[model samples]
Target: MRNRTKSVLESIVIAAILLVLAQTFLEDFAVLIGWSWNIRKILLFTGFFFDLFFTGEFLARLYTSVYNGRSARYFFAERGWVDLLASIPLLLLSSGPAVLALLTGGAAVFALGGMLNVLKVVKAVRIARILRLLRVLKLFKQIKYTNSIMAQRHVAKITAMTVSLFVMLLFGGSLVVSMLGLPSVDQVIADRHSQTVERIVSEMPAESREARNWLAEMTDSSDLLLVKRDGTTLFSRFDNRYYTELFGPSDYQYIPREGYDFFFDMRTLGAIQSKDNLIFFVIIVVFVLFLLIYYSPHFALTVTDPIQVMRKGIEDDSYNLEVRIPGRYEDDDVYRLADAYNRVFLPMKDRSRGTTEARSSLLDFDDVKGLLDGE
Candidate 1:
């Protein structure tokens, strides 16, 4: 009953972990698909809370293991290292520097010229979330200790392979994406501003006053600074005094412009990233599916089927009979197991049979002596 309760609790933990893992991946995917701000915020907070919870869990397990003098077994055999890595507060860690930079007016981060590059590298730490997949190992362990038909070596191996394949593809694909280098925030902003300027230029009126009126009707008044080709300001919506303070003379200017240059506001860049990252999105879906589908049947045939057959043979009292392994699998571990069992079982069965026959033949001597005495 105690074991059953423990199993039930552990099962609940695994289920919760699956949900958290899903949320973690979804948070990353949301960025590439331009999910809503509210949804992203919810995922972010959920991740933070779960990270804290897992950290506490790791600490509790660590203390318990140490108290029991089984620290090494817990850390190595029980995968404590995986728990430690997966329990890291990824959302908080990634957000820490950005928050500090903002609080310090960017000096805390940008004081050094290469600090921006360092921050970009820090963003990749989110990929460590993949380590959480290793928690599936505990599920296999749980199955082994419980009364489940699926509690077998093959099931454990398959679970390991599935988790390993997923982690490898996700981490490797994410690394590739990072190596290719996604567009920077500044670059995205500049490209959008240029496009908007070109479109507005083609439609603006020749007269400055009419152009100003049209611009006011079409765009945000505070964001545009329309100017003629000859260096004359045409329709300046910027506050002239603060404009000089905020922007340098050549800031946001377009090259070889005929009509005007417009100023655009900085906004969140998720939509642009989503559009540019379609290839990675497709790779994530297609590559994982292809590998899983390709390997499923192979696992069924080579691993699970052999284990099932061996188990059935033992249960049916067929240990003395040779396990009929396939010719091709003669070199495999399963074949060796069957061969070993047959070699030992046949000899033991023959010895037992001989002993039984000798006992039956000799047992009549005592009875014969007693009958002679009675006569």
Candidate 2:
């Protein structure tokens, strides 16, 4: 029963990790597809469901660890903080801003601290559960599990592959960004606009009669009239030819006939023009995340499934070595693994048979000894 419980717990942890990765990649994909606004809503719903299951299991294990008095130090110090941050979405909804702010600040600080001790924290959590599962495998220590060696090697290979993929993504993003020249484009446009505006303002002499009269009219007009760089006007008292050309027929409809206040707002304009570039960046990030997820299952199968099979085979003597894992591999690692296990076990099986036959032969000689005594 203890072994069964441990097995279930380990399975739950693996499932949680997979779900987290899936949701993360999916959210990134949605953003890349230019559905940025909707991605948040989708992720919120997905996370709520995932958190429900993960939170329950985490709490249960936490309680068990506390009750057992096993390394409560790490649990309370590191895992406890992660549990708190993981619950932030739910907690913030129920608490006041002040309380939420305090918790949020505390969580940020704790997270920074947690990063420093991440390896230790992960080891504590994974190792503890693994140790529990190993207890159930104590019986299998006597049996020669065929694919155990292959499974261990595959786990190392998968780890290296994942790390390499992550590094590639980092460099790829940097190269793409450099080629696009978004930063340079933005800076050049902004600098030119600034210089044009400065030159226009400096040319209008404050002492000139025409300039003084123009200033007076602007101040006297009920409707606001302000000249902006590139002939753009905001709430202008006069609908000048330049304004007419820039705004077109629809401009008069949106801008009141009466002059309006022109607040210098550049951010709105920038946002309108930068939408395409933002979408491009989002797409790149999403594509990379999707590729990672698409290959993740095969990666997990190569590593996880083999170890699981070896573990189960050790526990149950009836485990079939011929039960081939589903899915085809170009490299045939799984096939090679199965072949290796069979080779190792064939000799052990023959030795066991030979010993049984020799014992039977000795039993037959027992009657010979009895006949000699009778003679």
Candidate 3:
């Protein structure tokens, strides 16, 4: 009989890992693409949940394997190591910086936005979060067929490919971030004094000629000038104080409009330079989809048939000449598993073919020995 408890726990682990990988970058993604802040709550909740669940699951499995005499194999097994990388590193990476931020009292995380050089260690370890992709393989461990298939030599090859994908993703994401997140050299610092002038004018008392004069006195001369749309000057933060002395009449222009009113137009927009990054995004997405499609079909053909044959042997409580699976792929794991399975069962099937002693075989269920050997 299948262990339902183990199966359900494995399924939950798979679900949590999927949630973490899917939602991990959502906050940064929203900022990059300028999405609404409404999605931040959903992203934060899922991120916290998946990190906690994976951390607990990893600890439980680590302790159980150690206590159960499989400590070396548990930590060294393909599945075991992948689970370790996918869970613990992610838990620490997501939480450590946050804890440090809280302990140091109300600053942004990531060493309060990379303030401390020592905590740059967190940046180096952040790379391991990419290994969380390996958690996808854990879902297979619940299915005996897919589990065995993934445990084969192909694991090394898949790990290499996953690492390569990680590199490409990081490169592409960094390119996008430079374009969307970083400040340009020519970007202007908005005039803070203009904001003060707007607030003072809007909140002026019912009577006071001195109110408007005080606004001019309070603001600095190289700051932004506030002007009405009809060419009437409201106040000169710059032009009235230092007009034509440090500035030319041709240097400034009155732009008509909203809140902050008028401002300088100095900028070196990098939009044109980042055109290739968008193209790279499309290419990488298509490349990943192609890789998935190429390998997925091999699972159905190589894994399902052999496992079904073995499962039926246990379910029916007897072996028979019928339903024997022939090996088709010599290099594949399923072929090896099925070949071993056929060797064990073919002898039993042969003895039954010549006898009407099947009831005796049913009574002697203990004959099933070494069935899981070498799996």
Index of the highest-lDDT prediction: 1
lDDT of 2 by residue, 1-375 (tens): 999988796766666655654564554344344343344445645655555554565577677767878646535432343343343333232122213223474354236436643222221221121111111111122122233444433433343344334434543453454346446433454454454334435554444466445544544522123543234332244455644333211011111112222322233222332343344334534543443344344555666566566556544443535425555652477646655555655355456656664232323567688798998
Query: Model 1, poorest ten-residue lDDT window?
Result: 246-255
Q: Estimate the TM-score for candidate 1.
A: 0.51
- lDDT by residue for model 3 over 141-182, one digit each (tens)? 433433445433353346435644664476456445434645
* lDDT of predicted model 3: 0.49
Clashing residue pairs in candidate 2, if any?
223-259, 224-259
Candidate with top TM-score is 1
Model 3: clashing residue pairs? none
Say what the RMSD of model 1 is: 12.2
Model 2 misplacement above 4 A: 1-183, 203-269, 272-293, 321-334, 342-375
What's the true lDDT of residue 241 in model 1? 67
Which residue pairs in candidate 1 collide? none
Candidate 1, residue 304: lDDT:
60
- Over 4 Å off, model 1: 1-5, 28-35, 89-91, 94-322, 331-351, 354-375
- Taking all chains together, each candidate's TM-score versus the true structure is 0.51, 0.34, 0.46
**TM-score order of candidates, top first:** 1, 3, 2
By summed lDDT, the worst window of 10 consecutive residues in model 2 runs over: 130-139
